[model samples]
Target: MEYRKLTESEIVELQNQGCVASNWDSISVHRQFNTAYIRHVNFSGDIKLGIYEKEFTLPGGIKKHSGIKNVTLHNCEIGNNTFISDVNNYIANYKIGDNVFIHNLELMYVDHESSFGNGIEVTVLNETGGREVIIHDKLSASFAYIMSFYRHRPALIHKMQEIVKLYTQQNTSNIGTVGNNVKIINTGTIKNVRIRDYATIESTCHLENGTINSNEYDPVHIGYNVMAKDFIISSGSHVEDGTMLTRCFIGQACQLGHTYSASDSLFFSNCQGENGEACAIFAGPYTVTHHKSTLLISGMYSFMNAGSGSNQSNHMYKLGPIHQGVMERGGKTASDSYILWPAKIGAFSLVMGRHYRNSDTSKMPFSYLIEHDDETVLVPGVNLRSVGTIRDAQKFPKRDKRKDPHKMDQINFNLLSPYTVQKMFQGIEVLNELLSTCGEASVHYTYRGCRIKGSSLRSGLKYYDIAITKFLGNSIISRLSNCPCTSDEEIREYLKPDSSAGLDKWRDLAGLLAPSTEIDKLIEDIESGRLTCIEDINAVFEKLHKDYYSLEWTWAWDKIQEYFNLSPDTITAKDIITIVEKWKEAVVKLDWMIYEDARKEFSLPTHTSFGMDGNKKDQKIDFEQVRGIFEKNAFVEAVLEHIKVKSKLGEDTIERLSKCL
Candidate 1:
């Protein structure tokens, strides 16, 4: 982009075209710059202009050539064919790229050296100083997790901070950039923000000190009345509808709209937040909150849906707003549900009512925490039979909205992964301990500050056993799917663990579900400084996510040996058939339970409010018309289909194993 001095006649032509300049000698233009259609523009300091040879199509059918009108520039460089018009304040210290459009903006300027929101400390989770994560352009949820939660490892934190600081230093500049083909129209007070290629910013209120990591393939959108500061929004994200954010790192394809407000929060890929407020929360992939009264504050969550009026109290009277809670992946809250902080809810569980007892249900995945008589009642492992849980697991992979090739978050959507299975195993132990300590005939047992009734305890044990059998059977079938059982030796070989990494324990680090040993290896790498780069850490998470099934089989095999008291080397066809039979029973029974649960939705009590203005026969007709017959419902049909499919799968596998006899 070479520039030469403007000719005297060209300057006089620009003056005749109503282009005023404080110093004509300070202005320069490209070789083919023409003064056609340039009007009422004030140029100050050093300025460079490129040729405006292209025409732009307006919102309607009209086309107009690219030209500047009613604008002021200070030390700016305008690119070729760009349209700058009606800038009320000025465009200063900026480099506008080719084909960029800036129209009806109040002010767009770069005052001093800025990293554009990189290296801004976001105090996440614990709203205190110790857990601050310095957000950078490439900061992923996993990296922020380590920086915020693993603060005990000072050296690792220091190294990560140093890397971010280095990246920020490399990105620091005084000249703001508006990349090619960007549209910044009806914007107000855009200061020190770097607009990437093909970004569409329309009717934005304010954007300051941020990086819009947009590109041509997946352009970012900042629509009407959005206000942000000290943020780094990734590619393919849409922040609009009066959303306000500060010190936030918005991940790819996430949506924040409808007057949503967030501060000191990190929302990862595919998260949708509307009409709610988030503060100091680590919102991982698929964390959605759509209610106006929902306030997600001082918590860690992923794959979660906060129901309407869902709230959590982070501070007791004594803790100084320091307490935080965790609702592991796939957890959901019923409407108006609340939980006091310093509590842990299990994965895929449902929280129905307000609970202030600080219950910890981590070891009891897929359960329900209900409030009864001012006490929290735990119904453990019952959600394994829930149709909603199965639907959520099935839909997450299909609902992934991330279009960027380089995905920052590694999401694992497995419903029966080792992360939940291990919790089931431990839940069995805890339930048994409760039953043993308090007589099995006792009406209720208390554990973890939550009450469990005797009937619920018994049913919970049954449900957990069924789930364990199902998971083990699923793993065994998958393992032997390719390996033909020509002989007993091949069966023995197939039964052995693929890797030692999954034998002991497993964890869900937000959404990355893997064996604890793999997580340990990552932590050890960080401790040894071998995995210093954030990209390297993210690569480890991706690898673990990729090898999930293999590692899961390793964990399941060991658990099978422990649960069934059988050596894999000596197991006969009869034993395998017995396991398959158990799997069939478990699968059908759970599906039937879900079917019955679905039936409850269409019961007489449920239909009472539905047929409000009808007689008895008309009520029945109206209910059938509006809600449809229970048997013909979509979810009920799906449940019936699931039962048939799973039962057939079990029987087919058993028939395959019966040949080994």
Candidate 2:
């Protein structure tokens, strides 16, 4: 976009059209610029203007000519075919991109050298600022997870912080940018903000020191009284409806609206917050809170759903608001639930009622923490067979709205992964120990500040066994799905792991599930100064995500060796057949349990409140109208189909192995 000095005749014409410039010599215009399109505009400092050659077709098929009108600009470059109209307070020190439309804006400017919200320390997880993650455009939840939680590794933290500082220095500039094809209308007081391509800012109240990382494929939208400061909003996200954010990083495809307020929080991909409040929290992928009364404070959560009035206390009487909590992936809170800080809830667990006890259930996944008579009663391994649990797992992948090819958060939606399965294994051992020490007839046993009833303990063991069997079976079946070998040597060779990276403990890094060894290797690289760029760290996480399945096979094979007591060197076809039989039983049994649980929704007890002032027949009809019959439900039918498929799979495998016998 080359510019030439304004002609003497054009300057006279601009003056006749009520346009004035502080210094005529400092003004430059595009070669094809016409004086007819510049009207009643005041320019100060150095100004470069482009030709207004096109018209913008706005909503409702209204076409508006592209030109500068009734605007005051300072040290600005207006790109080709862009329109700036009715800027009340002036736009200063900005590069306006091509095809942009800015109308009726109160002010948009960069007052000083600014990084546009990069390298801003968001004090998340703890309000008193012990765990502060520097927010940046390239920051992933997994990356932030390490920075905020892995503080024990000072070298790694220092290296990461240095990298972010470098990024900030590289991006620091005196001029902000409004990218191509963007629309900013009826906005108020935008300062030191970098708006990216195709972003839509409509009726926004205020935006200060932020970076909107928008793109053509996944454009961000800020609408209706949004007040954001010190933020980085990623692609495909929408912040609207009187939402207020300070020191926050809104990740890709997230939605924050309906007067939601968040301070010092980090929201990862696919998170949604409506009519709620968040303070100093780490909201990982799929963390949702829709109700107005719910408040998430000083906690770390992922794949979580907070019901209405769900709240947590971050401060005890003796200290400041410094306490924090961790709710592992797939955790949920029932309506009006409350949890005290410094508590750790397990994965796939549900919390109900008010509980002040600082309970820890990190090793017990798929459980329920219920407040009963001022005591926290933990029912472990119950969510494994829950209909809602399976539904949520199925919906997350389907509901992912991120259209960007480069997704920052590497999310794993698996309900039964090595991370959770390992916990289940530990949960079974803990339950067994409880039974041994307290005696089977004791009826109620205590663990981790919660009471576990006798029936729940036995059920927990059964549930863990079923899930473990199902996971191991899935791995073996996938390995042998296309196996052409029939001999024992070929079978052992087929069973051998392709990679040994996942043989030990696994971790759920916010939402990404991978082996701890892989994560440690990444941290080691960072500590050793091998990975200095944030992109390099993200690339490592992506590589680990891509190689998840092959790595999972290594861990599964190790578990197989431990459980079956057969090494890969001596494993036989008969042993595999036995394992398949047990897998068949496990799969069918769990599916049956889930199916029965789904049936409970249609039971008479569940319909007690339905069909008011009507008979039993009306109650049945009313329940069926809203909840539908259990047999015809989509999830129930899928479960039934899964049972059939697994039964046939087991039969086929057993038949194939019988030929070796």
lDDT of each: 0.89, 0.94
Displacement of residue 522 (Cα, Å) in model 1 is 1.9
Estimate, for each residue in 1-661, the C-alpha lDDT of model 1 and write its tens digit.
7788989998899899888999988988898888896788999999999999899998988886888899999999999999999999999999989998888999999989999999899988888756898988887777777788787778877887887888889899999899999999899999999988999999999999999999877899999999999999999999999999999999989999999999999999899999999999999889999999999999999999999999999898785889999998899999999999989998889999999999999998999999999999999888987878888998899998877788888888888888888899899999999888988889999999899989999999999998899888888887877767766677788787776777788877767888878877888887787876767788888898889888888888888788888897797667777888988898888889888878888888777865578788888888899999999998899889988888888888887887788
RMSD for each of the candidates: 2.0, 1.2
Q: What local lDDT score does residue 122 receive in model 2, on the 0 to 100 scale?
A: 92
Give all TM-scores, in the order shown. Answer: 0.95, 0.98
Q: What alpha-carbon RMSD in Å does predicted model 2 have with respect to the real structure?
A: 1.2
Model 2 bad stretches (over 4 Å): 608-615
Candidate 2 per-residue lDDT, tens place, 93-212, comes to 999999999999999999989999999999998888879999998999999999999999988889999999999999999999999999999999999999999999999999999999
